[model samples]
Target: MVIRVRDLVKRYGNLTALDHLDLDVQAGEIFGLLGPNGSGKTTAIHCILSLLTFEQGTIDVFDCEMTPDAYELKQNIGVVMQNVAVFDELTVYDNIDYFCGLYISDKAKRKQLVQEAIDLVALNDFVKFYPKKLSGGLLRRLNIACGIAHQPRLIIMDEPTVAVDPQSRNNILEGIKKLNQAGATILYTSHYMEEVEQICSRIMILDKGRVIRTGTKEELKATISLGEKITIEVENLPSHILENIKTNPHIATFDYDDHVLVARFIRGENGLVDLLELMNSSHLQLGRVYSELPTLNDVFLELTGKELRD
Candidate 1:
């Protein structure tokens, strides 16, 4: 295991932040950490990294117990947090060089590693540009480059794509996949569900400082009763028909908005067909009919309850 935590417990004053959370991260896989705001995701990560004091539990990294002074183990770990950390006085090249120098002392080795990091993040064109001069996307790439300059075996990325453009987001995600393929284990945390579904090999969802569920995207979807969502684009759905859809025994829930009528079914076969048939029998005109399988978002909502969090 790249990282292992057993009976992890953390508290803040009177409130318990982590309630004996247990977690394991395998080697050479992109593991996703997901939770709503204030779910103790950050607290758990801080505890695992040995940056914060915990009330109870064990944290092991690279087959050795993790501690604040584990410099050897810490040397092999790279972290790119949500907040951008870079030297405003330094250019892109110098920033990566400074970070790489922390883990490497030989000048020649540091130069090579810095260059590789720059190339990996595709920041060759902006090497001489100061951080303040770069765009939001470019700055994000630079942040990643600095974290990875040492070629760490385990990378922890927390919201690296936040507030970046779509193109930059794709580039960052692709670079992360390449890194994983090249033998680095990744612990990725993101608010975007689609990104997690797209690249994560395994996913863990947390709530109230405890693990709600952990599995692959397919496995997570299977855990919920929601099977498929059928949508029909129809204008002006009548109140009677909307009420009738709510009466469906097989349907878990449904809604209509903006010429779109969406129905969610619970492990039902031919749900789309039945919904379409019902629409036809009601003399409703359909513009577009689409069927989609359950997604990670659906699993999250089902397990955590469909209520907005603060």
Candidate 2:
């Protein structure tokens, strides 16, 4: 394991922030930590990095016990927090060079690493631009370049794609894949379900300071009762048909609006076929019919309760 936490607990007086949280990150995989705001995700990371003192439990990174004084261990790890941390006075190239210089003393090596980092994030054109002059997307790329310039074996990114444009988000995701291909293990934390489902090889869903489920995307979807969602676009849906769909044992629920009927089935394989047959028998003209598998968001809502815990 690249990182291992056993019975980790953090308490503030009588309130428990982390209650016996256990987690593991495998080497060379994009592991995602999914949670809402204030779900103790940040606290767990702080304790693991020895930034915050925890009341109990053990955190080991690279088979060595993590400590506040573990300078060597710290050198091999790179952290890019949710909040952007970069000097507005420094240019993109200078920012990357400064961070890389911390781990590499050789001037030539640092220069090469900084350039490589800039290229990895496709920030070569904006190398001379200062943070204050760059767009939100470009600034985020610079932040990534600064953190990853050191070429650490492990990289922890917390909401690295927050508030970025679609193009930049895709660029970041592609860069992460390239890093994994180059043999850097990554720990990613994000509340965006689609983002997590897209790039993560394995996922861990956390709620109330505890890990509720951990597995691949397919495996995670398997944990929920919802099997598939089938949507049909029809000009008109009879009132009786809508009522029948709602009352079906296989169907969990459905919504009808704007000449569209979306039916959700909870654990029925032939539900879509049945719905299609019913529509045909009723002479309903179906414009579009599509069946979709459960998403990480569906599994998240099902396992953590429908209520917003954040």
Candidate 3:
């Protein structure tokens, strides 16, 4: 394991931030740690990096016990937090070079690494631009470049795509894949389900400082009571067709509103075919039909109730 967190616990006076959380991340895999706001995602990260002192348990990085002053281990780890940490006064090149210099002291090697990070984030054109001059997306890219410029083997990115343009989001995701391909193990945390689904090889969803589910996306989905969700749009959904779909054993629940029939199937082998056949036999004109498998969001909602968790 590249990172192992066992029985990890953190407390802030009376509130428990991490409730004996157990986590493991393998080498060369993009692992996603997903949760809602204040679900202990940040706490777990802080504990792992030794930034905040945890109440109990052990955190191991690079197959050894981690320490706050583990400079050798820290050198191999790169962290890009949710907040932008680059200096507003510094240009893009300077920001990246400064962070890279922390790990690599040799001027010749540091220059090459810094330039590579700039190229990786596609910031070549904006190397001289300060943070204030850049758009939200460009600023995010620069933040990433600063973190990964040192070419750390382990990269931890916390909500790196928050409030960024779609194009920059795509660039960041692609850059992450390239980094993993080049042998960097990444721990990515985000509230965006699709981003985690797109990039992570394995996912762990937490709620209220505890892990609810952890597995490959397929594995996690298999554990849930939700299967495929079929959506069909029609000119007008008849009451009979809606009732029939709702009454079907394969389907768990259905919603009909504004000429759209949405059926959620908890379990079934041929849900798609069965749904289509029923709709066609009932003389319901299907304008658009889409069948989607259970997503990471569904799994999270299932494990943690829809009720709000602080």
The local distance difference test score of each candidate is 0.88, 0.88, 0.89
Per-prediction TM-score: 0.93, 0.94, 0.95
lDDT of 2 by residue, 7-116 (tens): 99998788788889888899999999888877777888788889999999999999999999999998999888788889988888888998898889999988889989
Writing each residue's lDDT as its tens digit, candidate 1 over 1-310 gives 9999999999999899999999899999899988777777778878878889999999999989999999999999998878899999999999999999999999999999999889888999999999999999999999999998899999999889989999999999999998999899999987678899999999998888889899998889889898888888998888888887899888888888888988888964457777778788889888988889988778888898853132
* Residue-level error in angstroms, candidate 2, position 115: 0.8
Residue 157 error, candidate 2, Å: 0.8
Ranking by TM-score: 3, 2, 1
**Order of models, best lDDT first:** 3, 1, 2
- Candidate 2 residues lying further than 4 Å off, grouped into runs, are 307-310
- Evaluated against the true structure, the overall lDDT of model 1 is 0.88
Worst 10 residues of 2 by lDDT: 301-310
In TM-score terms, candidate 2 sits at 0.94
Which pairs clash in the backbone of model 2?
Answer: none
lDDT for 307 in candidate 2 is: 33
